[model samples]
Target: MNKQMTRAFATGLLAAAIALLIYLYFSPTQDLSVEKMKQKLEKDDYVVVNATTYHQQVNELARLQKEISAMNKVKPTIKQKETKKQTTSKQKTNSYHLVISSGTTSAEIGQKLEEAGIIHSREQFDEYLKDHHYATKIQIGEYDIQQSFTFEEIAKVITKQK
Candidate 1:
């Protein structure tokens, strides 16, 4: 009686194994594996990355942008007489509205300021940016500037706009 029962149990286990194999072989959906992942990628499909890594990358990007803006600040060199002259001329200054974008470099900003008659020279303005170590500190916004503003005043306005 013991030998007969052992034989029946072995047969049942073998049958179950065969049924599982057949089910897997005939299934409509393929099993998840490296092959499936590769195929999906080859089809130009989007895949999820680790959420923490993605968030870290985004935070790093924002931090870099802020640093860049702060590093492009302008420094001006002018004599006391020149400053007095500039101050006196400010009353007759023409107004201009300028828009600065976040990704714009210091050279571009200087060029724009020069074009608007806010600064004497783009090269000088660029040098000021380098000398002052104002990288990405220039606020990204719409600004109302005037031609009569001194270089120092313009720098302060551009860098500290609310």
Candidate 2:
């Protein structure tokens, strides 16, 4: 009877010790100080409290800057096209037809268009045609182009001819 009591007491003490150890291991009372934070940063090479949020913000700012630059860049082209439209309106009221030959260079076509008052500037027309890859495809023939026709219409008219 005495041995049984001793064994029961030993088992209870062992169980209590195990429970105490487990509670201590899983407890959230761990110390975290500035020195510990610095040590963590050094160990991890770098540290950010909200890395993903910071990265996303930086990307958004870069995209906005790019969009602003693009908008600013397009303003000049819009103004130029508007001015050309005004000038062409005056010329269309008193323009004549000019004949163009096949295999004509883009520069020649541009010059003829300008001379016939179809466009405001030969250089501008040439640049436009070149940029659009239409310089080499202009059909050679007599065209009745006038400033009244939009550039788009003129391109279609020139390309539609065999």
Candidate 3:
């Protein structure tokens, strides 16, 4: 009777051990192995980095930010110049009115100006007017030119009616 009882106790113990092993094998409590995790990350096209390396990269970024902030405090001054170029151009483009008789070619106008002693030479005046493209723009009428007018000024005057 003692031998049979001993045998039954051993059988029960063996059955419990087998059940525990099977439960452990089918359990979801096991974490993925490090090598398996790495393979998975690689297959998913992800980069795996250690914690210390990631912290060092963050520290380097902070250092660069501090250096940039320090550099922004110093400002530079530059001098700007005011030029008379636009004013001169505006003066040249100004219009005026002139008094003249009919049938006035650019050469005739130059001759009139020379004869009146307004300009020195008819040839120079004609060339000046021609170079400035004032010939076609000339008008025949009484004119009021501004003091010290250029050929460009006269051309503007001649082209405009009022």
TM-score computed on alpha carbons, candidate 3: 0.33
| RMSD (Å) per prediction | 21.1, 11.8, 17.3
Local error of candidate 2 at residue 128 (angstroms): 1.0
Per-residue lDDT of 91 in model 3:
50
Question: At residue 21, what lDDT does model 2 achieve?
Answer: 99
**Which pairs of residues have clashing backbones in candidate 2?**
101-140, 102-140
Measured with C-alpha atoms, the lDDT of residue 98 in candidate 1 is 78
Ranking by lDDT: 1, 2, 3
Worst lDDT window (10 residues) for model 2? 153-162
Best by TM-score: 1
Candidate 2: tens digits of C-alpha lDDT, residues 1-162:
699999999999999999999999998996789789878887988854567899999999999999999998999899999998877767657565766776677677778777776777888777877787777777766667767776666766776632
Worst 10 residues of 3 by lDDT: 74-83
TM-score of 1: 0.41
Error of 2 at 91 (Å): 7.0
Worst 10-residue lDDT window, candidate 1? 71-80
